[model samples]
Target: MFNEIEAIIGKAKKNKNYTQRGAVPSEEIADLESQLKIVLPKDYKYFIKHYGYCFWFGGVVSGLVGDNKRYEKLCCAIRKTKYYHDFYDHDSSYLSVPQQGLVIGKWAGGGYYFLFSQESERAGEVGLFLTETYGQEVSKFNSFTDYLSFLVTGTPDPEPVDVDYDRIMDIIED
Candidate 1:
């Protein structure tokens, strides 16, 4: 998974639209998990740890570092999650805000925000929250990697790459 993500990052790096904000330290990621009160999916954690936040393809993947206050302040997952939670609570007509979910990122100036589920059965999976429908009839992804691939290349599953779980575990364990 890391290798495939690396390839995606490499491709994005060459594009003018890609702008890496910064990489987050492990501590900050942990702090974010604490703030969100959920253990984030492993793949999402890896992205945050190694790449931090970024603006690429057509959206911003936020992190602890808010480089541009005006933009990042609104895009921040923590804030978005909290706000949406309260929002949906007040208005039940709209699809309920994802339960135990975090707003990972968005596309097209917040036209859509990706919600990462922390629920036991759906952990690591992401669902699109189209602002227009309030997330009804939303698209879904198997994992963070798939969601990211869609954001980067307009596909859920990109070119296949061999994955050695042992090696990946070793790298991530450190």
Candidate 2:
């Protein structure tokens, strides 16, 4: 899966901003789960385990191993810092995140791509959330893998029909 993404990204002539890094150590994954107090989805685990610090438009705006400076890591690095653009407050972000929801990725604008970790029915599904205009948080795809596929390629990883990105996009544009 990682290789496939890299291939698509490689094909793009405008991929200079996207940076895909090496895999995260298994021990680090375990430690992150322990610290975050949440069980990561299997696909998500596989993704970070294979790729780290990966994303487009300057950095990985989503996932655990995203760019540290522009994106927040779920561990101690972001808890005390106030540089990233997370919707939830940083001091209590950890406690609120896995419980309320988990933000896996983000769009170039202000919307966030998330998963509802506390709700089993919504488990593994990823969504987009834009709080600025009081927009609804809507599902974007079926899983983390789906989101990544869309990111590297112009195609949907799982392709969702229920998502209302267009509605939110309209609101965002206003």
TM-score of each: 0.76, 0.62
Compose the digit string of candidate 2's lDDT tens values, residues 85-132. 344445331222334345565445765566554345677777665444
Misplaced by over 4 Å in model 2 are 1-14, 58-61, 65-101, 117-119, 133-135, 157-174
Question: Each candidate's root-mean-square deviation in Å?
Answer: 12.1, 6.6
Which candidate wins on TM-score? 1
Residue 92 C-alpha lDDT in model 1: 43
User: Candidate 2: minimum summed lDDT over ten consecutive residues — where?
Assistant: 75-84
What does candidate 1's lDDT look like per residue over 76-154, in tens digits? 6777677766765685444566666687765453334544656557788776665455334246778888877776777
Model 2 alpha-carbon miss at residue 148, Å: 0.9
Best by lDDT: 1
Q: Each candidate's lDDT (Cα)?
A: 0.65, 0.53
| Candidate 2, position 46, lDDT | 70
